[model samples]
Target: MNLKSSVGLLFFLFTALAKAQTDTTRIKSYADQVMVRMNLDTNIDQFIFTEGPEDKQLETILMTNNKTRLSFSVDYRIISATLSITPRFLPGNNDNELKGTSSYTDFRFRFFPKKFIQTVYYKNIQGFYLENMKDLFPDWKEGKDPYFQFPNLRVQSYGGSTAYVMKKDFSLKSIYTQGEWQKESRGSWVPIMDYDLSIFRNLIDGQKSKETQYSFGGSMGYFYNWVLGSKKRVNIAPNISLGAGGMFSSSWDILDDGSKANRENTEYFIFKFSAGLHIGYNTDRFLFGGKFNVNANVYNETENQSVQNNNIFGLLYIGYRFPPPKVVERNYDKVQKKIPIL
Candidate 1:
């Protein structure tokens, strides 16, 4: 389906399931508590382009130099938000001399209503260098020779996902946002819909080009949260999903005379796979966890050319929960009186 239609369908499904009955016997809610989290992660933003047939295929990998990110987040009631940045002080984040300078920024927000989860995010990434220089050049030396770089290539994406849990007793929140805890082990089937708009800009030899892509997809995932320990404070969760989608892309170039060239449009079928494992220790007031997640998308650009976008990340986080102050609670109550959704 198209992006608009996919979004409309997600809205309809969300409203239909908004009031779906829920059982909280196996879960514990922390709606009255404010959660603050600090996270350190190694998140790679990269893409691989392959051309020609399998035996004679040529591969070009583009990757950002900033490989680590630190983020801070706060969650209260039904709302959560996070801001992330890559700092040069980090060990692996400051190799600008070898990989060229790069920058990355991300902002995300999430809302929870009953069994439905809604998320929205924005990401900005620029500057990439060829990661496999040795394969391309037989005499290339890693420290002595500089790799090919795209100094003016930038990608920005706006995206979000909507999901609903089919099981009433399972706590998806426990595995994701940590807003709630599950007292018993359980599993659930979750159906999710995701949509995104991406803009790519590049400048080469004073010529500018821009491309825009729109994509949407639906997927079904199974999540199992295995609770352990006598105190029920330790858990391991693993989830996987497979999906298919479509992408519409359009591109145009700026001519030397300052005129625009004819826009080119292309459509492609996309295949997606995502899996993750989360292990955490949670208590009423303190929590710490680690997570590993990977997502891959493959699409053919032509009969002999294809592109793959691979995202892999590992995260470690520690958080604290406490009762919200009266002023904070009162303000939220006031906002909720008008919006009602919170």
Candidate 2:
């Protein structure tokens, strides 16, 4: 080839390389901006890509103008093209499967904007019980005990809870070993927290006393996906948490005339420890799961009267898993950034 022609070709190649590098840097800046807008600027565990076959390589990138969100994959796939909303409907027997009906609904929304997903939940329960009241107060006597005798003993509670789960997905490489075709399993460790407030009513004989409780806590756990059959998988997660809260009970007195009088409020500090096991089956579109939770609460009113409460419950839930939107990768070189930088 002539020297002039060779020089021209080299110039063209250099220009292309520079442009590609510039695009990589530009997309990264845009991603950081989206994180800041979503108030997740410091969260390193947030995932911005979708999981797929390793050979079917794709690069996902997020771009935002602070007001508008745009995302695309390297192969021009629409990684975050369309948004999806899934509403979870759950109804089941009481926590202990002892009696009563328990139900709750959750609404989930996802967006390409910081890959945001939000869940809002509300629950109403009646006649739900923890355990026999006699178990907590073992030294009960008809007239000698500080409390009066009742025909039946049980608890009724109703409350609402809200939680934020950081959006995340397993990448293909992390799901498999190097050069191995072992069925790639998906797993994610995300930050999850919830707040709950409830009113608990205790029935003694035929009379009623009420208490209000407030609790907030966070837990870290891994959701491991296992293939159960063709095109089907099961998700299992185990978690532990610790929390602090308080409870306020309204004091009431029963007169000799069989009348009831409301007294002042009695307050107690509550410390909570909980462990949960969750198992679920999932198709490409829907997921169904059963969760068993056990928690213990230590209540201290003073140095004299301290009590321990145990709660056990089972919940069944069903929801839809929306398809991830098309992804656009601007900088394919940095696609494998470590996630959940725990």
Candidate 3:
């Protein structure tokens, strides 16, 4: 080849390389938006220039990190199974604090001809929401606020759900769950009724209370996936979900006489919503990516009393894909000889 022809080829190669780099940067930018919103600790550069094989059909997606672990595999892209675990963390100056943890297991066994998918899931979560009470009394003097020490609060919840996915992007889910909590408050808190009774009344100061809630709810969401790069190896998906439910709750306070007092049992309502973004680089060998989710929940007992919870979190993970198993053939005559007559 002539010298001018060789120079032309080199320029073409350089241009293609520059375009590939730019696409990688764009995917990283989208990942950054989700991470920053949830305050997750991640390095974008570590993920941008990753090395992997060319894109192919992925039968499974597995990912894990300090806060979340997810593993899901499928058969013929129709029948699927998944396992996920999520842990809660509260940011602190020196080290992050563990707020809670939960486990989720599900199986998607039913598939309609071309339009629908269904999943049955079971979940159990145990944690506490400590931020609200802390914000309520930021500076409590030890002597003056003797009854106002930080609450030893704990919440336990378990539930199951059935989800239907339609057209591969939209989903409608219904869930039934039960939860129990031990809660307490002091320093003269207002009650949630027509009367002016407070939690920290003269009759019931520094008392611990027990509450239980049963709820049924449904959620609707959509997910969109974008593939970038000439080889279609990089993928990103952003999803949004909204849900509402009614809950039956019952709570009673402990009186100074070591007996239950002010027994109140009533039904309440709750609403929740969340938005998440996920990014990954998938190849024949392995997959790597991170997901960030921000969510909020509101609980209302009466028209005048309500509690709100807002939380943000995310996870980073790397996973490997296993090869499909080989099919085995059996001889009918040999099997019949080994069988005993009934």
Please give each candidate's TM-score. 0.91, 0.40, 0.48
* Candidate 2, 302-325: lDDT as tens digits: 554455554444455444333224
How well does candidate 3 match the true structure, expressed as C-alpha RMSD? 20.2
Query: Cα lDDT of model 3 overall?
Result: 0.37
Provide C-alpha RMSD values for all models, in order: 7.4, 22.5, 20.2
Query: Which lDDT value does model 3 have at 144?
Result: 37
lDDT of 1 at 322: 98
- lDDT tens digits, residue span 151-241, model 3: 2443344444444444322111100000000011001111110101112112224767766666666667544444557665665545556
Maximum-lDDT candidate:
1
Query: For residues 1-342, what per-residue lDDT tens digits would candidate 1 score against the true structure?
Result: 532354354344333343342344388999899999999998888799999889999999899888889999999999999999998898898778788999999999999998999999999999999988998898999898888999899999999999999998888888888999988777778999999999999999888999999999888887777777999899877777778889999999988887779889999999987777788999999999998777778999999999999887889999999999999999999999999989
Q: Backbone collision count in every prediction?
A: 0, 14, 0
**Total backbone clashes of model 2?**
14
lDDT (0 to 1) per candidate: 0.87, 0.35, 0.37
Backbone clashes in model 1, listed as residue pairs: none
lDDT of 1 at 208: 97
Where's the lowest-lDDT run of ten residues in candidate 2? 36-45
Which candidate number maximizes TM-score? 1
Residue 223: error of model 2 in Å?
5.2
List where candidate 2 sits over 4 angstroms from the true fold: 1-193, 202-208, 215-232, 253-262, 285-290, 315-342
Q: After superposing candidate 1, which stretches have Cα over 4 Å from the reference?
A: 1-25, 256-258
